[model samples]
Target chain A: MTAILKMKGLGFSYGSRVVLNGLSLAVEEGEMMGLVGANGAGKTTLLRLVSGVLKPREGRVELAGVDLPGLRPRDRARLVAVVPQSPSAPQGFTALELVLMGRNPHLGLLQWEGPRDLEACRRAMELTLTWDLASRPLSSLSGGERQRVFIARALAQEGRLLLLDEPTAHLDIGYQPAILDMIEEIRKETRITVLAAMHDLTLAAQYCHRIAILHEGAIYALGKPGDVLTPENVSAAFGASVHIGEHPVYHTPVVLPLGRRGDDG
Target chain B: MGLARNRRPPREAVHPSPGARLLSLPYLSSHLAVALLALVVIVIVAGGIGSVYIPPLDMLKIVADKAPLLSLEHTWPESWDTIIWQIRFPRVILAVLVGGALAISGATYQGLFRNPIADPYLIGVASGAGLGATLLLVTELPIYSHGLSLLPIAAFAGGLLAVSIAYSIARQSGGLPLTTLILAGVAISSLASAAISLLIIRSDPDVRPVLAWLLGGFGGTQWRDVQIVLPYLVPGVVIMIAYSRILNLFQVDEDEARQLGVNVERTKLILIGAASLTTAAAVSVSGLIGFVGLIAPHAVRLIWRHDHRVLLPLSMMVGAGFLVLSDLVARTIVSPSELPVGVVTAFCGGPFFLYLLRRRGRVTL
Candidate 1:
């Protein structure tokens, strides 16, 4: 399969502080790619670069043989859907209203949403199991419910590339798997590419086709979950001691943390 | 990105209807209709009641007579026509336009800043305009020439300057923090208000007219005043309405808004400029009317959804009707002499504003 997203020597800096440097990778058209990193490991910064929200300071990205950052903001948005971590849920707005804003890229200047736009949103909400929360105010929803709503919004964007930053961070045990399974099902059906920044390595190992571990402004390891999620690699990336096991049903990696690497224990 | 791709639905399928799309919605239509009808009735009531007391039926006939090819036999007294047409209509129209201008501008600011409590008055926009108008009035510069009024121009420039200063001062490394923005606005407002006081004190004319204007009312408003405000108000309102959809995106996270195709900085500048212009135009005529902007948008948001496509128009309607009715009470409640319309608005609006603050405690940006 051909790579749909190509990043060549990408680098970024927030003023004098470099966040990600000399990052290069290719994402195939339809695979689910998990980005596993600890806090400040530059996962969010890299995702922002790929989504064209933050321009790369060193190199460039190309999506579908076109320069990503060179494209207009609306054109880039039409190609990428993002579920930002900890997005502010406007209290006065309802869940459906927030979800409908996903259609912003496709809409023309001054255009209101039509019946078809609403239909697209409804389909996304149904898939995410958030249709029931449509009329509820965002302020009243629990964190998990709001997280699902945000996911639904990303789904409603209907872009080819989906970038999710902590998509299931606030979700419970039941919802975590259910939402991941839904995303997997959709990706299989529609061939949409997913690049998700995940804090939980075990969850990443389960759903993602390939896992990339980012450490110190670069990818330390990138391979299939079985190859990349070994104990040494995980310990090195996160700087924490961890025992690696296998899932009973899926046979993917399951990481059991042994606490901080240099703690008293 | 591919010539052979078939991903998004065809553009025509998702295209919004060409005209008045919000009014045609099944759920919102009835409410919009009611608001619209209420505005019509309020206009008539506001226009009809004065010292002379022209009836609504006669007012309608007089208005119709002015229309070409609509010659109705005049059965009313001659002076009644002058009272209805010359004196009353202009004042009522001024009230409507100014109120609508303030409400829509307020909605624009509230959306752009993502602060529910934001308004023209709260952000020091009105004080700036008030200062501008005070400067013009005190200087006795020729305000009207070439069928345009320089008063709104001066006010618009001054208001825009003040808001830009406030916005820049409020800017942090991350973004515009709302608390800082409010603090800056308050600081700017006092400075401008102090400047106005100095100007009036130094000029030392009959301070009564300036004081009357400062307190805010529509007394002695001429047709020329309405003519002056339109050049700024109409375009300002149009720009805000056009930007309403984009403004909703601002309520979302700014980065997400950018990823969703909004030019965040550009949109911010445009909406701020438009809102300030509208506020300046309204203030130039109505002089420091407070809280109609705040209360009207709040009422619409409370009763209806917070979608700005719906919010903007409904707020304008509510504000127009509310101010016309307020003007009615201001002029007639005491009879002969009038209370400032701003006083009436503040009487109701002050508690409502307080209640909102107490409930929300801190409005997050």
Candidate 2:
């Protein structure tokens, strides 16, 4: 399979401190790639590098064989769309208005969103099941509803790749699996490449086609979910013990957190 | 944690047709029309009010007489025509220009900073211009101004300098936090204001001119002042309108806006430059008219919503109308003995802002 996203010797630092360094990975087209790591393990940093929010100080990032770092922001946005960990918009904007902003990159500076742009927004909103909420104020929506609306916005960008940072963050159990299911459903039809930072390792194991474990600013392990999510790897990367077992129905890894080296459990 | 996607059933045929968006179009335009109409009405009525109370209809005719297409019979005294054309009209037009410029500047700053309470006056641009005007006045600087006062050019440079300092002070790790920016602006405003006070005290034995500068009015306004303000105001407004879409994207968090392909840093710089230029031009002639900036845009947001496309123009019209009325009240409320126009705006705007702050703290910085 051709790789849709490729990173080689990527390095990013904040002042004297390093957030990601010498990181290299390739995500295949039509595949769901999950980035899993603990706090400060560089999961979000890697995603930001790909989305062009933060530039790599050292190496190259290419999306579909085109250089990402040098492209102007408007051009880069046409290639990839991102949903941040906690998505927010200013008050008084309706869901339709927020979704319409996804068309911004496609538009000229003075150009207004015409009928065709609205049609694209309509289709995107329909896929995410946020069509009915178009006229409603964004602040009036519930958490799950808001998540769907933001996903609709990302989808409306019409980018070739979708990057989601902490897709299940701030979501309840019922909504978490549903959002993943919906994303899978959307992917099945659209065939858009997805690279998501998953805070919940089990959800990552279930949803991602392949998983990578980020450790100390590099990919510590990369393979199929069942191969890469062994108990030893989780313990090493996270600095804690996890009892890894087979998920009964899906035959994926299910991780249960245990206390670290010396804890009062 | 995987489950069937059954949480939200496919919502019924609730997606409104394209007409849904098209429907809101007229609603916005009608409000815009109302604002435009209000401004026209206020300008005409305000021209008629003041020391000489000409009827609003006669004021309309006198204005129409100036237009080449129509010439009505000369009904009133020639001095009345002089008052309408030479004296009152120029002053009123200056108020309109100042008010509209200030409002647009306020709306632009608020959008860029992502705060509702943000305005050029609150963020030291006005203070900087005040200092610049004083510097020009005190030092009697020889500038090669052709038909333009040297004060506005100096004031523009000063205002730009102040905002640049505030922005740099607040910038951290390539991001400007709202709280830090506000604090930095407050500090800079204090410094510029102190300098202005010192210049006022030390430079001039007669305090009237300095008092006029501090109070901010169009008491002796001429058409030349209006002409000097135009070159700055026009291009600044065009840039603001051109960037309104990018400004909408900015309402989201910075990272998201960047991800959506907005060049955040460049847009911020251009918006700040244009807004400051506009603010300084208004301050140069009008002398720090207060709160028209804050009140006008917020009022527009109340009637319509936060879409800067409509917000910018409607705010301009509303601000122009509001200030013309305010100046009318300022000059006529005490009759012959007039209050400074800034006092009128401050008195009206101050309590209104306090009410906003108290009403569930809606007017947030």
- Top candidate (DockQ): 2
lDDT of 2 by residue, B1-365 (tens): 22354435545664574433722557768887888888888999999988888998898888889898787999988999889889888999999999999999899988888888888776678888778877887776764466556766777778878888998998887666766777888999999999988887888687676677767888878888889899999999999989987899989988999999999888877888888889888887788788999999988887776889888888999889889989999889998887789999999899878877787466544
Interface RMSD (Cα, Å) for model 1 = 9.6
Model 2 lDDT at residue B54: 96
Docking class of 1: acceptable
The runs of at least 3 residues in candidate 2 whose Cα sits more than 4 Å from the true structure, single-residue gaps closed, are: A260-265, B1-14, B17-29, B138-149, B167-181
Off by over 4 Å in 1: A260-265, B1-30, B137-153, B167-183, B200-206, B355-365
For residue A58, model 1's alpha carbon misses the true position, in angstroms, by 2.0
Residue-level lDDT of model 1, residues B208-311, one tens digit each, is: 86787777999888898888789988888988988888888888878899888888767776777788878887887778888998989988887876888889
DockQ of each: 0.36, 0.59
Clashing pairs in 2: none
Q: Highest lDDT, which number?
A: 2
RMSD to truth, every model? 5.9, 2.6
